[model samples]
Target: MRHYDLVILGTGSGNMLLDEEFDHLRTAIVEPDRFGGTCLNRGCIPSKMFVITADAVEDARSAARLGVHAHVDPVEWKAVRDRIFNHIDPLHDSAVNYRREKGVDVYIDEGHFVAPKVLEVKGEQITADTFVVAVGSRPVVPGTPGLDSVNYHTSDTIMRIDELPASMVVIGGGFIAAEFSHVFSAFGTCVTILQRGPRLLTAEDEQVSARFTELAAQRNRVLLNATVTSVEPHGDGVSVTVACPDGTHVIEAASLLVCVGRRPNTDRLDAAAGGLELDEHGHIVTDSAYRTSVPGVWALGDAVNHFQLKHMANAESRLVRHNILHPEDVRTLTNRVTPHAVFTNPQIASVGLTEQEARRREMDYLVNVRNYAATAYGWALEDTTSFAKILASPADRTILGAHIIGPQAATLIQPLIQAMALGSTVDQVASGVLYIHPALTEVVEQALLAL
Candidate 1:
């Protein structure tokens, strides 16, 4: 058995946990896939880059509405694909080189836990004094009949396709679905979204979800409360049969993108063999300090968190690194200001509790909603379909949560996140700060004021 002082089972954010402080100790990083993991190779970065192009194309098409006679040339799929991956693929190589140069053992294969604190990688037994399982998650394709026989793409493979589809049928209504649907639809694909849930982005505030669904329907065909019965190969693409309350119908598309959800990669690691406690969904169960049920073993990121966001995983990486070094002085991970955003058309962002959550908890709160049309910037953009909503504790006026769906929604929600993180009240946020006149941030100011 090869032994080391530390072993990190995955390289997503696990790769970020390494530094000079751990140079003295022998360490090993086992990554079955790419060195930089999902976000760098597939998820956030690449998707956003593609989304930017789509957004630009969309703006050019709608430039007439703004009285700007601009035209966009046809997008060469190969150029865009090569441009993004050419930049991204090198970073992964560089990361691997850097880690190896630092005297860290890099195993480019799957690592499975066969015993406590021990993993089997490429027929070699690796044992470490301490282990951090940051294996993350993978795209989960629903178990629909004949799905395996059809050619389909997940978020991982969709962005890297050589050619854009003439039409796409997206399955799911979550962030992945919303973002990809926007990307393809704006890029001129006849996009159709089939969602089992009643609304897209069910995690957001109800009002925001409703508005987003309504707006999304305007751009593409959105079938809510619909479930897929089967997926099979059609002429050159695929056919999807969806069952709704009324009846069943077949939708054909040149491409199918499944964005239903993601499941923790714990199963890939065989964490149970290591005697680690896992939740019902197979995610490692950790305490506030990110310590697993077994001592000397830790897990973080999507392996333990419900928010499968890159920023959240990065935050946990910093905390886990510190806790690993100073086990005696372990600090609890705090997600009090956890915020996430969906990079779709009329982008959405949120921090803290939703209205449904607050009501479920039976908290006495006041809800305030301000449409983008109410702001001067909104008028400039001629945005008639976006808004921001704020929920606050009525007694102290402290903001409980904030949700936004509009241009620059992600950037606009940052100040509100700062307020909630620092315990700033609604009154403080609305009156204390200077919201630039006729700026998009005025929408935030108005929402807070309404609260």
Candidate 2:
């Protein structure tokens, strides 16, 4: 058995903790797979690169509406996949090499704690005075009958496929389904989305969900209120049986992308053995200061956070670092104003409460909506199907939430996020700020004013 000052259990956000302050301590980082973790290798970064290509292709397809008709070239799947991975793979290597050179012991093997503060990695027993569990999450493959016999892809594997499938059947109603559907459909592959929920992005405000569903349905076959029963092999492809409100039907496609959701990696960690607590969903239980049930044990990122976003993970990582270093003056995470965005066609960005959540909580709030078509920039893009939604407390006029769906929705919603984070009011955002004329942000200004 060997002991160390610290042992961080993941390379995702955990990789960020090796700052100058920690350089004096003996530390080890355990990463069983890729060095940079999910967001870099599979999730956000590379996926967005793919979405960028889809965006360009989509713009060309809609160019005729803007009186600039041009045909897009057929997508070369090999070239696209190579371009992203070729660049990202090297960066992962560089991260690992750089960390090792900094006097940090890097363990490229699966590891878990056998006892409190003790970890077992590749037949070696190691102990640390303090430990950080940042192991992330993995795609959950639902147990549908015969699913094992057929070929299917999760978010992890789908992007690396050698060639684009002729057509695809996306299973789920979340951001992954919407974004991938956009990518494949825009790349000229036929796409059909089978969602168990009544609508896509069910977590969003109801109106925004309806509008996204409306626009998405125009581009791909969307089957809502769908329950997938089984998956099986079908002549060089896969066949999916779905139980819809109408009736049970079989849909065949060259590939199946299961985007149902992700599950935390805590189960594999055997947390109970280490006297660590976990939630019902198998997420490691942690306090606001990122401390686990057991003293000297901390967890963050997808392994513990409700919001499994890279930015949130980074924030939590920094908080954990501060708390670990200054145990006497521990700092709790300030995550009340976290924002998220989905990179799909007519992209979606949101911060704060959804109207449903507010109503469910019985909070007194004022909500308002503004259509993109009403804005000057909307006329330039000829956009008709997008809008911005804002909710604010009437008493203080404090902006509680903001959601946008349209071009640059991710970038446009940032100002609203800033307002909420800075405790700004709806009127303040609309009147106090100077919004550029004929900009898409005018749509946001309009929404705030309506509030």
Candidate 3:
């Protein structure tokens, strides 16, 4: 048996802990998968790289509307896939090597707690004075009948396929489904989405969800209120049987991509063995300081957060680091504002409460909506369906929430996120700030001004 001053159970955001400051402490990191975590290996970063290419194709397709007729060539799937992994894999290897060279016991194996403060990895039992669990989540695979028998892909495996699927039947309508749909569809692959809900991005403001669903339906075959009952291997592809509100339908496609959601890896960690409390969803329970039920055991990242966002995990990691180092003077995380964006076509981003939530809570809030068509940039791009929706407190005029859909929606939502983080009012965010004339960001300013 060996012991460590600190042992980070997962290498995702947990990787942030071992720095020059922790040099004096004996540290170790355990990870059976990639070192940089989901975001770097298969989630945010690689998806965006694929999106940029998809966006270029989309731009060319829509270029005729700008009076600049343009054409796009077929996307080389292998080349794109190879180029991405070629870059990302080296970085992952380098991280593993760098940490090992630093005398950190980099265990490239899955580990779980066998007893309080003790973990077992590759037949080795190690105890740590303090443990950090950042092992992220994995894609949720719903038990559709015969699904296990057929070959299907999740967000984890879909990006690395050898060839771009000719036609895909996508199950689920969240950000993951929307993103890959945009990528493959832009690359000339046919896409069909099966959403169990009435709309896509149900978490976003109602207007944004409605607008995105409307736009998405135009680009791909979207079956709303769809329930997938079963899947089976058929021919060279898969056959999906869906029960819709109207009737049941059997759809065949070259590939089946499931993007229902993700569940935390806490189950694999055997969190109970460590005396860690977990929610019903298997997420490690934590306080504002990222401390678990057991003392000396702090957790962060997807395992501890249902948000499952890399940026959010990073924020939690920072807080946990401080709390572990200064146990006597522990400071709780204050900034609770979380912002998220989907990099699909007519990109979507949102932060804070949705109007439905405010209405349900009976909060006194003012709301405004500004369409891209109302701005100079919108006219230049001939954008008609995109808009920004903002909500603010009527009393203090503090920006409560903001949602955007359209070009640069991800980029445009940053200022609103900043305003919320700073607790700034609509006037403070928009009234005094100068926006570049004719820029798309003016759309956000317009929405705030209206509020």
Candidate 4:
């Protein structure tokens, strides 16, 4: 049996566990696919790259409205797609090489939990004093009729298309669906989004989701509260049938893309063999310290079934690493107000409570709304979009929540996240020192003032 101090199940956050502090220990990193995992290769980086390019193209096309008379030349699909992959492909190699150089055993095969403290790597039993299962998640394709016969793309494979389809029909109205709708629409494709809910971004605050739905309707076709029946090939394209409250409708497009959601990659690990229990969603059950039911075994990231964002995954990984080493002072993942951002054109970022969430919890709160056009930078950019910066409180103005919409919404929401994480009051956030004038951050300052 091969032995090591640590046996990381997956490569994504697994690599992050290798700290200078752990240099004295022998480590084995097992990853079946490419090294950087989903985020670096297919999920976050590549998708954002496409989103940025789509944004630039859309802006150029809209410039004529401002009398700029600028025109965007045709997007070179091959060149653009290749450029993004070219930059990302190398990082995977570097990560693998760096670990090998550091004397860490890197297994490029699947690792399954065979026994409580044993892992089976490529049919070989390997034992470790401690283990971390960082196996991430993959896009979930709904089991719709005729889905197999037709060519459908998920978040993973959609970005690798040879060229943007002239028109596409997207399934689901979550973040992936909304973001990809914007990207394809901006690229001059006829985009249609079919949502299973009443609005897009169902996971976000209701107000934010409603506003996003309104804004998205301006750029593409959005069908909400619709249930998809099937997808079938029609000539060179495909047609989707959906059943709604009123009746069934047929929508035709050149391509069909599914962005419903993701499922944790725990099945392949045979977690049951390790005595680790999983929830209904197939995610491993873990305590705050990222520990499983069995001793010496832990799970983090998407496998834990908590927050699936990359930042959250990395944070959980760090916490797991510390707890495993110390074991004395175990830290919980609670109390940290996680922030999320959608890469749509104007972007949407939020942290802490939503307006409805605050009210539901029966917390007395204050809501504030702001417009991008009200700011100088907004005027310079001829902005017409609206954004709300909500500061909720329990009559004491403790700053329970903050949400932002419009340009750079993600960047503007960071300070609010810091405030929430630190339990800073609204007064503290408002009184905090901020640089003056000629900055987009002034929007945050203005919103805080309203609070």
Candidate 5:
């Protein structure tokens, strides 16, 4: 049997485990497909590349409102798509090469747990003192009737398309749905979002979700509370039958995109052989220290049921590394405020608790909101859409949540994230700091003052 001190399954953030600190310890990595995992190959990096181009196209179209009178030429899909892949594909290859050059044993195959501390990879048996499972997640396809017969694209396969469809019917209203909706819509496709819920962006604050729905409606049709019963392939298109409170409605489009959610890729790992427990969602159950039910086994990233963001995964990877190095000094991955940003037009970003969550908990919170139009920079840009909302606890004036919907909303929410992570009070953000005049961040400062 091949032996090593450490063996890490999956190479997403798990690759971070190969720090110089672990150079003394013999390590082996097993990866089935790409080296950089989903974030680099398919998820975050690629999606953002497409979204940024869409943003540029949208900006050019709206230049008339900004007094620029700019006309957007046709988007060369092939050229644009090829450029992104050209940049990313090489980086992916280099990542794999770097791991090997660093003297880490790299095994490119599917790895399955055969026993508590043993993993079988590509017909080879390997044992390690400690093992890390970070296999990540994949798109979950629901069991809808006729879905198999109809042609559809998922987050993983959508970007590799030869060309953009003329029109698309998007199923589900999650982050994947919203991001793609904006991408395709900005690219001149007639986009329609079919959400089964009452509103889109269910994970965000209710007010923010409602406002997002309104803004999205301006660009494309948003069908809310519509449950799809069946989908069938038409000639070069798809027919969707949805049952809603209004009644049954059928729609057709050139393509259908599924953005429902993702499922943990734990089934193939044979975790049961290692005596590790998984939740009902198939995510590995880990303690605050990222230790699995089985000794010598640790899990993080999407494979675990914690925050699924790339930054969060990297953070957990560091925590697991620390625990592995010094079992005596344990660290917990809790009490840290997690922030999420959605990349839609009039982008949405938020951290900490929602107003509704605070109210439900009865946490003595005060709410304050500032319209983006109220800012001087807002007038210079001729902006009349979106707002910033802040929620703070009354007793200590600590920022519980900060939500924004406007240009650079994702960038503007970072200060609040710093405050929440550092446990800074609202007064510190509002009075102690000096925001550049006529900047987008001033809007954040204004909201904090109101709180």
Candidate 6:
């Protein structure tokens, strides 16, 4: 059995946890796949790159409204795919090389616990005085009948398809489905989304979800209250048997992409053998200090956090690193109001509590919604469906929640996230800072001021 001071499992954000500060301790990293986790290899970075191209295509299509006709010729899927991965795929090799150069042992294989404080990687029994498990989540594959027989793709494999399909049937309503659907549809694929819920992005505020659903329906074939009963190989792709609100039917498309959800990787890690407590949903349980139930074993990122967002995972990683080093003085996650964004048509971004949560808590709150059409920049872009909604405490008018849907929603929500993180009141956020004239941010300013 080989032993070390620390053994970090799964790269992802855990790779970023290492710096010159830990030079004294003997460290090793075990990864089952590529060095970069989902974000670099599959999720955030590559998807956003695709979205930027999709956004450009969409802008060119919508240019006629601005009295400037534009056209995109010869949309090359292979070139776009190669360009994005050409830039991204090399970074995985660099991460491995960088760690090796730093005198850290890098094992490019999966590791699982065989005993307390011990993890076995590629048949090697390695024990560590301390363990940091940052193994991330994977795309959920539900047991829809005959699913395995056909060739299908998840977010992990869809981006690399040799050619853009004539049509695609997406089987989820979350951010992944929204983003990819926008990408392919903008590139001329007939996209259809199958959502089991009544509205897409059910996690968003109800009003925002309803508006997004309305907008998305206009762009693609969106089936709500849908359930996939079965799937089988038809022609080139798969035939999806869907039971939706309307009736039972079959959909034939050139591609099928499943993005139902994701679950933490604790089960695969055999965490029980290591005496780690996992929640009902298989997420590793951790205290405020980011320590697991086991004394010498710690976990962060998707292994512990239910947020399951790359940014959230990155934040947890920073705290876990500190807690591991400074055991006596560990920092808790201070930014409770973590913000998130969905990069799709009329992009969506949100921070803090939703209005439903406030109402459920029976708190006195005020709500204000300002549409993009009311802003000067909105008029310039001829935007009508985008808006920003703000919720605040009625008593002191402290900002409680903010949701935005429109171009640059992700960027506009940053100031609101900062305000909420700093516990700034509505008036302080609305009036304290000056919003530049004719900017899209004026929609946020208008919403907060109206609140």
Candidate 2 vs candidate 4, lDDT winner: 2
Instruction: Encode model 2's per-residue lDDT on 1-451: one tens digit a residue.
Output: 8789999999999988888899899999999999778999989999999999999999998999989979988999899999999989998789888989998999999998788888899999999999999999999999999889988899999999998899999999899889999999999899999999999999888888998999999999999999999898999999999999999989999999999999999888888889999899989988789899999999999999778899999999899899889889999976579999999998999989999999999999998888889988999989888888999998899988988998999999999899888898788889997999898899999888777
Residue 55 of model 1, lDDT score: 86
Position 377, candidate 2: lDDT: 91
List ranges where model 1 is wrong by over 4 Å.
none
In angstroms, how far off is 104's CA in candidate 6? 0.4
TM-score of each: 0.98, 0.98, 0.98, 0.96, 0.97, 0.98
lDDT of 6 by residue, 1-451 (tens): 9899988998999888899988888999999898779999898999999999999999998999999999998689999999999999888888889989998999988889988898888898999999999998999999999999999999989999899899999999998999999999999999999999999999999889999999999999999999999999988888999998779989999999999999998888999998999999999998887789999888888888877788888888898899888988989987788789999997999987888888899988899999999999999989989999999998877888999999999999999888888889999988998999989899999998888
Off by over 4 Å in 6: none
lDDT, each prediction: 0.91, 0.91, 0.91, 0.85, 0.89, 0.91
lDDT of 6: 0.91
Superposing all C-alpha atoms, what RMSD in Å does each candidate have to the true structure?
Answer: 1.2, 1.0, 1.0, 1.6, 1.3, 1.0
- Evaluate model 1: give its lDDT: 0.91
- lDDT tens string, model 3, 195-294? 9999998888888999899999999999999999989999999999999999999999999999999999998999999999999999989888888999
Name the weakest run of 10 consecutive residues (lDDT summed) in model 6.
305-314
lDDT of residue 42 for candidate 6: 91
Looking at model 4, residue 147 earns an lDDT score of 93
Per-residue CA lDDT of model 5 for 1-451, tens digit only, reads: 9899999999998988778888898899989978888998889988999999999999898989977888777788888889888988887578778888888998888989888888898888999989999999999899999999978999999998898889999999988899999999998889989999999998789999999999899999888999999999988999999988889988889989999999888998888787889999999998899999988899999999645688889899899989998899989987578888888787899888888888789788899989888888888878887899999988988888988988999899998999988889999989998999899788888888887
- Model 3 segments more than 4 A misplaced: none
Angstrom error at residue 373, model 5 = 1.0
Clashes of each: 0, 0, 0, 0, 0, 0
| Candidate 2: residue pairs that collide | none
lDDT of 1 by residue, 1-451 (tens): 9999999988999888999999999999999899878898889999999889888988888878789998877678789889889989988788889999999999999989998898999999989999998998999987899999999999989988888899999999999999999988887789999999999999889989999999999999999899999999999899999998779989999999999999999998999999999989999999888999999998989999888988888888999999989978999876558999999988999999899999999999998889999988898998888888889998988889989998899999999999998899999999997999989999989888777
